[model samples]
Target: VRPGESTQDEPNQKWETEDWGIFSSKVRYAAEKQLDTAPLSQAITQLAISFVGTTYTPGTLEV
Candidate 1:
């Protein structure tokens, strides 16, 4: 959004909180949630399962 602002390749600069521009939050949120009363492994497993019905299109990432 400015002149001479080179499109530099860097980590967590432009999109520090986005995952594929969908849900946005830091990893600490998941870490803390997992570290709660539930075991981290279980939390991770359930979290992975939670996205079962979420929309996803093949080849989108291929571009």
Candidate 2:
């Protein structure tokens, strides 16, 4: 995973909340939503490509 830049030292420190419980819950919710949306996002991309159809014709490509 790409690491985000920190504006201060101890970058591992939670910036979300004073309570650990709240911070962890928010992280979990965000991660789950991203996971759920990933497949649909990929599907939409594939559908768009299918709609565009093949860009190359057979025998047109050569070594």
Candidate 3:
């Protein structure tokens, strides 16, 4: 498979309901604050910082 691509038979990363909620909130906040107008790096940094303290599971992409 191509980079970051998974097949139907492979185990893939799954987002829980809470994860979706967090994503939705971030998208809404970004829209409301017009973060899209900011420089790409700045916007990416802002979004990355917002995930502080989030739980991360390593090896999720491993087959």
Candidate 4:
């Protein structure tokens, strides 16, 4: 699905079908792409804040 990819291939279709939940619901199925404008640090901070009070194993991806 880079630039000129075909969907007629069976393997490609199978992989897409296998992960249909995430792909179909969340993904924006279009041929165009754009740059993300939001800053990475800010995004990470916002996401980390959500887990600030949650008890996760001491230091493993817990905010």
Best TM-score among the predictions, by candidate number:
3
**Cα lDDT of model 2 by residue, 1-63, tens digit:** 123433355555433333455446555655655544568777556444543644656863342
**Candidate 3 residue-wise lDDT, 1-63, digit = tens:** 344455467647455666567778999988876899999998998888887997878975466
Clashes of each: 0, 0, 0, 0
lDDT of 1 by residue, 1-63 (tens): 133233356322343223523443324556556645577788777667656787888854441
| 28 Cα displacement, candidate 4 (Å) | 14
Q: What's the candidate order when arranged by decreasing lDDT?
A: 3, 1, 2, 4
Comparison by TM-score, 1 against 3, better one: 3
* Stretches of model 2 off by over 4 angstroms after superposition: 1-18, 35-63
lDDT of 2 at 23: 48
**Higher-scoring candidate on lDDT, 2 or 3:** 3
What TM-score does candidate 1 get on C-alpha atoms?
0.37
lDDT of each: 0.52, 0.50, 0.75, 0.43
Compose the digit string of candidate 4's lDDT tens values, residues 1-63. Answer: 432343565333333443454344323321122113447776555545544775656653332
Cα RMSD (Å) between model 3 and the true structure?
A: 6.1
Each model's TM-score? 0.37, 0.27, 0.59, 0.32
* Candidate 4 weakest lDDT stretch, 10 residues: 26-35
What's the CA error at residue 5 for candidate 4, in Å?
28
lDDT of 2 at 35: 47
Clashing pairs in 3: none
